[model samples]
Target: MVFSWRKRKPRNGDKKVHHMELEIPRHFICPIALDLMKDPVTISSGMTYDRESIEKWLEEGNFTCPVTNQVLTNFDQIPNHSLRKMIQDWCVENRSHGVERIPTPRIPVSSAEVSEVLFSVTDSKRRLDRCECLNSVHKIKKWGLESERNRRCIVANDAAGVLAAAFDAFASDSVEKNANVLEEILYVMNWMFPLAEAQLLLGSKPSLRCMVWFLKSNDISVKQNSINVLKELTSCDQLYGERLAAIDGVIGILFKFIKDPISPLITKASLMVIYHMVSSPNEKTKAELVEMGLVSLLLESIIESEKSYCERALGVIDKLCETKQGRESAYDNALAMPVLVKKILRVSELATEYSVLAIWKLSKYEEKVLIEALQVGAFQKLLLLIQVGCSGETKEKATELLKLLNPYRPGLECIDSQDFKNIKRSF
Candidate 1:
C-alpha cells in the first residue's frame, strides 16, 4: 500500500487542466525505497521518507532536500505520525495485497524538553538540591550524543555553563562522598569540550583543584578526563598562565601523567603541557621537571613514541638542557648519550638539532663524555647531519659540535658538508 502523486493543478493564469485516474493510487511509494515508507520521518525540508532510508542517505553525505534542492539547517528527524496513520489505514484496506503496518515510533527528546531539564538548575529552592541538577545535566549530555540536533540544543541552551557551575559547586565543597558528582561533571565536560566561557571557568583555581583531585580519583575514566581537560585548558593562551600552571602540585601531576600515563593521549598531553611549562624560561619549573626525572623519562619516551611525540620530547629536552643540572642528569642516564646520537639525522631535522645541542651541552664541560662521544661515532653522525643538509641553524649547531669535538679528539676525520669532495682531517 504505497502512494505517489501523478499530477497537480497548473500555475495561475493558465486555464490548462489535467486529470488522472485514482482507481488504485500510487501515492504510497517512498522516493528512496520505491515502496511504502515504514517508520516514516519528516526532515526539516518537509520531505517524508522511511526513517532508515533517509538516515542512510544523510549518513552517506547527502545534506539537502532530496526533491526541492534546498539545504537543510539541521538533521533533526521528526516522526510523521499523520502519514504513518494514513499508511496504516491503507495497509488495512489492502490487507489482501500483503501490505503491513509500520510500528509505532519512539518519542524523541525535544530541544524544549531539554531546556526545561536544564532550567531546573536555576530553581532557587532546588539550588542546593544537586541530584536534580546532576540528573538533568546527565540527561542533556546523553541526548547531546544521540544526534547533532541534541548537541546544538545542549550548546544553544548553555548546558556547558550549567554543568560547569554544578561542577564548581561540588568541587568547592569537596565532600569526600560526593566524588561521583565530580566524575559525572568531568565526563560531561569532556564530551562537551566546553565552550570558551565554560573552559575559562573550569580553568579557575577552585575548578583546577577539583580537576587535580580527580587525577587522584580511583576512577580511571575520571583521571583520563581530568588530564584531557587540563590539556585543553593549558592549550588556550589565556589559561596557561599563573592561575593554573603555577599552582603547586600541577607540574607533579603532569609528571605523573608522563611517568605512568594510562594511555598515549595522556602521554601526548603531558609532553605538550611540560613543554609549555618549560618554554617560559621558568628555571625553577625546568629544574623541578629535571629533578622529577624528566630527562630520563623523555629519553625513554622518545624511543617509545612516534615521530611527533619524539619531536616534542626533543624540543623539551633542548629547553631543559639549557640548565646545568638538566645536562648532568641527562649525562647520568645510560641511554642519554646513545639515544641522543642515534636520533641525529635518523629521527627528524628538529631532533637532529636537539641531539647536537645536547652533545655540545654535555660534552663541552665533560671531556670524559667527549671521549665517549668520539668512541660512539658521534662525530660521524654530526658530520653526516651537516652533509645531508638541515636547517641553517641546525647545520651551524652541528658544525659547532663537530668543531668542539675535533679540538678534543684532534684526530677525528670528517668532511665538510658544503665541500664533501675535499676531505678535511682534524689533527
Candidate 2:
C-alpha cells in the first residue's frame, strides 16, 4: 500500500468537490408491456410512483398512438364465435316469439334448371301445374335470391315454360289469388328477358288462346288484366307488326267490347291498343280501321257516349289525324265528315269542344271536303257557333275554316262582325 494515488471515491456528504456533477440513466426503465409509467398516483408530496403508475399505464392502453391507434386489419378482432352465439340467441328469441322470417329468393332460376324442371315435362297441363307450384313456392317464402334465380332460370330455360307460366297465371280463375305473382312474371317478361322471346311467347297460339279465354271471361278484372298483358306485349317495337297481324280481328273484337255496357274500361283500353296499332302510318291498317267502321264508331262514341269514353274516342281520332294517310283515309270515308259536323252542331259545350277538334282534323283535307261541309251548312253552323255557342279555341278554328272557305264569299260573310271584334279584343 505504498501510497498509490488512485482517484478517491467521493462521499455523498463531501464538500471539497470543485465542479458540480449529475447522472442520467442510459435506457428508459418503463415497462414495455404497459407502454407508460406504472403505478402512477398523485401523492401528498406532489410526487407519484410505481404501483399507481402501473395502473395508469394499463389504463393508457385503452387509448393509443393518436395517428395509428388500435385498429384491426383482419376479422380476428370481432371474435366470430362470440358474434355467432349472439346471433343464434337472437334468432332463437325471435322464433320463440313466433316472428316469421321472410326468405328472399333471387330471380330467375338457372336456364338448365328451368329447362329441366319446366320444359322437359311435355304435357301442357303438367306445365301449367308446375307453374302454379313454382308460384306458390315463391309466394310463401318470398326469397329474393330465389326470385332472381327463377328469373335467370326462365331466361335460360325453355321459352315455352316462361310463356306457359305467364299464360297460366293470366288465365287462372283466381287472378285475385295470383295477381301479385302474375305482376312479377310480367316484370320478368317485359324487362328482364330478351324481347324476342317475350314477343314469341305472347304471339304464340297457346298464349293468344289463353288471352282470348281471359277476354271472354265473366270477371271484369280478369278481362282487364288480360288486356293489360296484351297491351304490354304489343308495346314492344319488335312485336308490333307481327302481333298486329297475328291477332287477327283484334280490332273487331275490341269493337264488340266497345258495344258492351259492362266493359267500358275494356273498350277504352282496346281503343288505345288500336291507336298504337294504327300509329305507324300503316296504310293497310288505316284501311282496315276504316273498313271496320272505326272512324264512324269513334265519332259516335265522341258524340253520344259519356265523358270518359268520349275523351278516349277523341284521343283515338286525334292519333288517326296525325298522319297524311290517316287524315286522307278519314276524310275519304263519307260517313266521317258528316257525322263529325253533326256532332259539332248537336253536342253540349264540352262535347262541342271535342267535336270541333274532330272538325279541325277533318278540315285539314279542306280541298277535298270543305265544299261538302258548305253544302251541309257546316260553314254557317260553325260561323253561328263562333258567334254564340263556342269557346275561344272553337272560334279560332271557326275563323280558320272561314279563311279556307274564302272562295265561298257568301259563307265567309256569315261570321258576325261583333264576334270578330270580340275575338280581336280577346287576342
Candidate 3:
C-alpha cells in the first residue's frame, strides 16, 4: 500500500509546538548530516547516507568513505528505496506526532541519456525544427545546471563542438526565430570549457562570421556569451588568437564595447579577448588594436575602474606597449605615466606587475618618458616594489628602471619611498 504523511498544524489555543521535540529513528538519520535521510543512497563502501550529502562530499574531490575512511573504489550511488519506503512508512505511522513524509527524488541523468539528448539536438537540426532544437538544447543546459557531474558528462560528450555547429547553423537565421536557440547554444557551450578540441571547430572563417554576427546581437547576454567564448578559444592556443586577429572589423566591434561601456562583465570579457588576440606572436594584431584608439580607451578604464577591471586594462596596455605604435600612443597621453605609476602596489601583484611593464617598455627608449616616470614618483614605487616583493621578472624590470632613472634623479640620494643612505647603486 502506498502511504503519505502530512504534519498537522496545531490550533491557536493548544500552545504546543507541533514537531520540534519528536525523536527520529537512528537508522533514518544521514551519517553525513546528522539529520533524517531524505534520499538515502548506498555507496561502494557499503555505507548509506543522504544522496545530496554524499554527492557533495565526492564532488569536493574526496575518495574515502566519510564513515569508515576507507578509500572508495567505485563511486556509484545505489538508491536505498526500501529504506526510503520504510522511512515514509514510519512518517505515516507517526502523522499524529507531526512527522512529514520524505519525497521521492528523481533519478539523476546518466551519460547514455546525455548522448541521446545530444543526438536529439542534432536530429532536430537536420529536420529543421526550431522548437525541437531549442527544447533539446534547453535540456542539456538544465542537466548541466543540475550538478557538476552532469557538466563533466556534457564536456566528456563533445558538447562544445555540437553546440558550436548548432550556433553556426542558426547564427544567420532570423533573430526572432532562432534567438533563444542561439543563446542556449552559447550557454551550454560555456559549460564545456577548456574547449581545446572545440577551438579547432570554432577557428574557421565561418565560425568567426558567426561570432561577429552574435556580437551584433541586441541581447546583452548573446554578446556577453559570444565574447566569453572567444576569450576561451584564444586562451587555448595562440594560433586561435592569430586567426581571430586576422578577421577584419572584429577588433573594432570589441573596442566599441569598451568605448561605449556595456556591463562590467562584458567589458572585462572584451578586454581579455583583446589581451589574447594581441598576445599572439603577430605584432600586427597589437598594431591594429592601437590603430583603433585602444590606448585611450584602456587609459579611461584604468582611471575609472575597480580593482579587477583595473588589472585587466593594465594587462592589455602592457601587451600593447610591446609594439612601437602602441608605445608612441601611450607616451602621448598625459595621463599615462601618472595612472600607471598610481596603480603600482595599489591594485594587486598582477596589476602592479603589468603597470611596471608598461612603464618600463614605454620609458625604455625615450628620455622624456623616463623623466615623466621619475616625476610621477615611478622611481620610488619601483624601488618599493623591488624591496617588498614581486615576480622575478617584475623585480628585474624595476631594477633596470631604477638604473635608467637614477641619472635623472635630482640627487643620487633617494628620499621619497625608502632610505637609500646605506644603499649602493649596482649600476
Candidate 4:
C-alpha cells in the first residue's frame, strides 16, 4: 500500500524526512473516541484509549470496556508510554503540516506526597507559624485541584480534618485578624464535604461564634461559604444548632439572608439551617424565630420558590407552626391562607403535606381560615390530594381539613381554582 507521506529536502547533515498529509494512522486513534489520543493509556482489556474518554465512560458507572465489551478486571490505567512517544514523534515530524505535539502529562499524586503536604500544614499550625500554615494550605489547595485522583487522595488523607483544625484554631483565637487564611481554608474545604469530623471540631463555642462573625462579612463569598460550612456543621447536631442560635443575632442574620438573598444557594441553605435548628427546638427558640418575622419570610419564600426549594420552606413553616407564637405570626400574614392553600397538591407531596398541616394548625385558632381555604380552592385541592397520593399523615390532615371546610362546600362555583400547570406557567 502507498504511504500518505510527502518527501522533504535534507537540511545540513540532516536525513531526509517526510511530512504527513491529512490522513492519520488508524492505530494512532483511540478505540473509544475514534480520534488521536493525547494521553493514551492501556486498560485491563488490552485496549488503548485517551485517558479522558475512558475516564468519562467509567465515571458514567460503566464496568465494561467500550470496545472489547469485557468487564474491567482492574481500574488502573497504565500509560502506553511507547505509543505516546511514537505519536509525539509523528507530531514533531508533521509540524509543518499544522500538527501540534502533545505535551507530557503529569504523574498522578501519590499517598506519600499528600501525607507530606498534610504534615507541612499540621506542622505549621503546631508551630503557631501563620505564614507557614498559609503557604502550606495554598500548596495543598493547588494539589487538590490538579486531578480527581489527587483530590481523592487528599480526601483519603483527611485533608478536611487538617484544614478544620487550622480553621478552628484561627477561628477560636482571632479569625478576623487572619481573615485571608480563614477564607482560603473555607474555599478549600467547600469541596471536601460530608465534613462530619470537621463539623464536630468546629462545633465548639468559639468556632461557632467565629462562624457567626463570618456570616456578617461584607464579602459575599466569605458570607456564603461561612454559611455553607455552618450548614454542614449544624446538619445533624441539635446541640450545635442550639449553641449557634444562642449566639445573639444569629437568627437575625439568617432572616437577613432570606429577606435580601445573596444568592439562591445561600437562601436555600439558610432555610435548611433554620430547618435543622427547629428540630427538637425549645419553646423559647421557636418564639424567637417567629418574633423575627420568620413566618412571613417562609410564606414569601414558598410563593417565590421553585419546586426544589418549596418543600424546604414549607417544612420550616410546619415546624414553626408547632409553637403558639409561630401559629400567631403565620396567621397575621395576609398571604398565609392563600399561599398555604395554593401549595396543597400543587407542589411535591412534601410541600402539599406541609401546606395541609399548616392550614390545619392555623384553622384551629381562627375559623375564618377554613372559609378562606374554601374560597381559594383548597377544598377541591384537598379532595384531589386525597384521591391522588400523599403520606399517611398528610392524608389524615387533608381528611381533617375536608371535615373542617365541609360547612362551606355549597359555593363550588366561587372556588378560584388554579391548576398546577397554570401556576407553574406563571412562574
Candidate 5:
C-alpha cells in the first residue's frame, strides 16, 4: 500500500505501462492482525498496529507490545494519519480491482463547539438563520454519542435546556409541518438524558405540556424518547416532575404504555416513573394509582415479564400494596395470592423480597387475608420457601407468616391437598 498522500505527477506517469498492478507493502500491514490497517495507530511501545486490534489488546489488560514484547508505559494509541493516507491512496489506485476508498472519519466535536451551539440554541431571539442553528445542535447531539468526552462537553454545556428550546420552537411553529424537527429534538433529548444534570434545565411548564402531547405520536421511538425525558425530569428535576405528573390523563396515558408497552424499556421507564410519583407518600397519589387499576396490570406484568421486568413489576406492586385499595384489589383477584406465591422462589431475590412483603402486608392488615392465603395453599409455597433457604429478609418475612399460620394448623390441613403433600410435616 502506498503511504504517500502526494499524487504521482504526469512526468513519472508518462512512463506507465498498459498493465495495472496492486501491491501492498509488509510494513503497511498491522503486526497484530497481519492485515492491512484500516485505522493505523502507534502505541507507546513504538509498535504500530490497527487501532481496533491494539485497543482490544490494551482493554484485555495486555501492557506489553504484541510484536516487540516491550512494556507499554502509556499505552496511548495515537492515530497514524500517514499510514491511513497511504492506505486510502492505494485503494484509490486499485479501484479497478474492486478496492473501495475509505472515507475520512470525523473528529469528535470539541468543548468550544458545544459551548457555541449551546449559546446559539438557547439564544432564541437571535436573527441567525434558524435552520443553521438547528443543524448545529443536531451535530452536537450526534457528537455526544460519539465519545465520552463529547458527551461530557454537550452535557456540561446544558444540552437539556437546548433541546427543550428546540422542542418549543418547532412545536410552537407548526406541529404537523415541523414534526420532523420535533422528532430530532426528542432524539437529542434521549441521548443527553441521564447525563450531567445540575446545569441542565427542563423547559417551561407550558413547553413541557407540549411534550405530553408527544405521547400520542405514532412513532414508537418518539414515544420512548418522550417517556425517557419525562422519567429523567420526574426523577431528578423535582419542579418539572410535579408539573408533568399533574397534566391531565398523565397516569392513564402512562398506564396504557405499561399495559401495551412498545418495548420492555418503555414499560420499565413507565413503571419507574410511576414508582417515583407514588413514592411521594401522598395518600391521594397512592389512591389515584390504585383507582387506575395498576394492581392488575402489575400482576399481569409479573406473570409475563422477564427477570428485570419482574423485579420492577413487583416493586410497583409492593408500593401499591401499601394502600388499602391496593390490598383490596390484590385480594379480590383470584390470581393475586397464587401468582404472588409462585414468584417467591421462581424469580430474583428482589422479586421474592417484594412478594413476601406483599403477603406479609395482607396477613398483618387483616387476619381474614391470612386465612384466605392459607385456603389458597400459600402455606405450601411458604413452607417450601423457608426450607429451601433465601435471603435473610425474605426468610424472616416467610417465618413471620408461618408463625401466623401455625395456630391455624387445622385450617391449613383443611386447605392442603395431594398436589402439595405432607403439609402436616412441613411445620
Candidate 6:
C-alpha cells in the first residue's frame, strides 16, 4: 500500500506557531558555519577576510539581525573562540552545583543599523546639530533619573542609537567636534554603562585621558580595552611627551598578565603597548621603561614566547638600544648585553641581521662593549649580512662601524670606495 506524505501545518492558536513565526532570518545567518549568525561577520566583500578581520568586527559589534536590522550587540552573540575552553570549564563547574542556564536580554539594535541611521541624516551641519541636541537630552535625562528610572529613560531614548551617533561624531573628520564628542561619550560610557558596553566604546578615541582611565580601572575588560587604545594612540603622532611620560608604570601593569594562564592576546597586546611606549620620542619614558625591568621581561619573553612575540620583543630591544640613554641603561644592567647577544645568535636570519645592527650601534658609544660584542662573533655576523646585502642602512652602518673598529685592518682599503659607490648607487 502506498503512503501519502505531507508536511505538517501549524494549527490556529498553537503555541509552536509563535515559535515558528520567530524564526531567524537568512541574512542574519553566519557564513562560516551556516548557523543563525551567532557571530556576525562584519567586513564588506571588498576587504580581505582573515582571523583578525573577524576579531575586529566582533570588537566593533558590527553584526546585525537580518529581519529586524538590529545589532546583536552582546558579547555572547560572538563566539569567544579564545575563551571557549575557559567558559566550558565554568559551565561544568556550575553544572556540578545543578545550576541551570540563564537567559540574557538581547540587544535591540546592531551597529550597522545605527550607522545607516546616522548616514540618513543628509546634511553634515544638520547631522552635527541633531547629534548635539540628542547628546544634551541624554545628559539631562541621565542626571535627572535615579535607579531603574534612569535605565528605563535611556532605553526609551535608545542607548544604542545615541552611542552610534557618538561614534560617528568621534570618527568625523572635523577634529574640533570629534574630540569633544569623543570625550563626552567616554565619560558617559565609563561612568554609567556596564563594562562590556564601556569596553566596546573605548575604541572611540585614543586620547591620553582615556588611556590613563582604562589603565587605572580594576575591570579586566576595561584594562584589555585600554591596552588596545594605547597601542593605537602610540602609533599616531598624537603621542606627545606628556602622554609618553605617563607610561612609566604601564609596563609593570602589563607584566602582571604574564602569569595569567589565559588570554594570550592580552599578553601580546601588553607587549605591543610596551614596545610602542619604549619606542616613543620621550627619553625619560624610554629610560624609565628600561629601568622598570623591561629588558628582563623582554628577555624572558623571547625564550618563552612564540616567534611573533619574540620578534616584537627583539624589535623593542633594538629601539631601546638605539639611543645613548638606552645604550647606557643596557650597560648599567649587566644582564642586557649577554641576553641580547644570545638572542642574536639563536633566532632567525632576520633577527641575526637586526642583532648585528644593534651591536654595531652599541659599539659607537663603548669600545669595550663593542669588543665584547665582537668576541661573540659580531664581525662574522656583520660580514655575512654585508655579503647578503641585507638592509642598506644596516650595510652602511656596518661599513662605518668596521672603519671605526679597525681602520688599518687588511680588508679596509676597498671599504671606503665601496661605501661611496653604494651611496651613489642609492642616489
- Quote each prediction's TM-score: 0.67, 0.44, 0.80, 0.81, 0.71, 0.48
Q: lDDT of each structure?
A: 0.73, 0.52, 0.81, 0.82, 0.73, 0.50
TM-score of 2: 0.44
Global fold similarity of model 4 (TM-score): 0.81
Q: Name the regions of candidate 5 deviating beyond 4 angstroms.
A: 1-37, 42-79, 85-104, 124-132, 144-182, 198-200, 203-207, 237-241, 383-392, 411-427
TM-score: which is higher, 1 or 5? 5
Candidate 1 per-residue C-alpha lDDT over 1-427 given as tens digits, one digit per residue, 9 for 90 to 100: 4232433455575666554432333555667876677677888988887777887788789989787868999998888888888878876886544445566654556668867877776551135566766676677667766666456657777778877776767667663655766777777777676456787667777788877777777777777888778777767754454455677788888888778877777778778777767767567888888998989989998875787788879888988888998988987888887788777766567777877877777877777777777766788777776776778877887788777778666664433243233233221
Q: What residue runs in model 1 are displaced by over 4 Å at the alpha carbon?
A: 1-40, 44-67, 70-77, 80-110, 122-126, 145-149, 175-178, 238-242, 260-264, 304-312, 345-410, 413-427
Residue-by-residue lDDT tens digits, candidate 6, 1-427: 1112232445575545222122323443344334332322233332212223344455565675333445555433333333333333443455434333322222334444434433442233345664654455344335434334334334444453445344444444453445445444444443333333323333344344445545556666656555555554454433432454464455556656553424666677766666676666667766766666666666666765666666677777787787676677667665555555555435555565556566666777886775555544445545645665656776787677666656333442222222223322321
- Could you give candidate 2's per-residue lDDT for residues 1-427 as a string of tens digits? 0111222345576656434332212221223332222122222222222233333443466333222343323211111233233434443455533322322212223345555444433343344554554454343224224444344435554543445445454545455454444434443444343455556556555555556556766777767766666665656653454455456666666667875556666777776666667656465666666666666667655645665566557666766666565576677667666666665545356555666666777777667677766655577667767766567877788788877766765642332233233332221
Clashes of each: 8, 37, 0, 0, 3, 4
Residues 1-427, candidate 5: write the lDDT tens digits.
4332322444555754343445678877888787778878888878789876886787789889998889888966688898889989987887756567876655646668877777776664143345765676677767867666567567767777666666666566656665665677777777665644421334455556656777787878888887887777667745565666778878888888887777888888888878777766566767887888889878876776688888878878888888899999988777787778767666766787889998898788877777777776778778877876778988998999989977776835443454355433321
Candidate that scores best on TM-score: 4
Runs of candidate 3 with Cα error greater than 4 angstroms are 1-25, 33-38, 44-46, 56-75, 81-104, 122-132, 168-180, 411-427
In the range 211-317, model 3's lDDT, one tens digit per residue, is 76788888888888888888888787887777777777888898998899878888888888888888777888788789888997789667867888888899999
Model 2 residue-pair collision total: 37
lDDT comparing candidate 2 with the true structure: 0.52
RMSD after Cα superposition, model 4: 7.8
Evaluate residue 6 in candidate 4 and report its C-alpha lDDT on the 0 to 100 scale: 58
Cα displacement (Å) at residue 270, model 3: 0.3
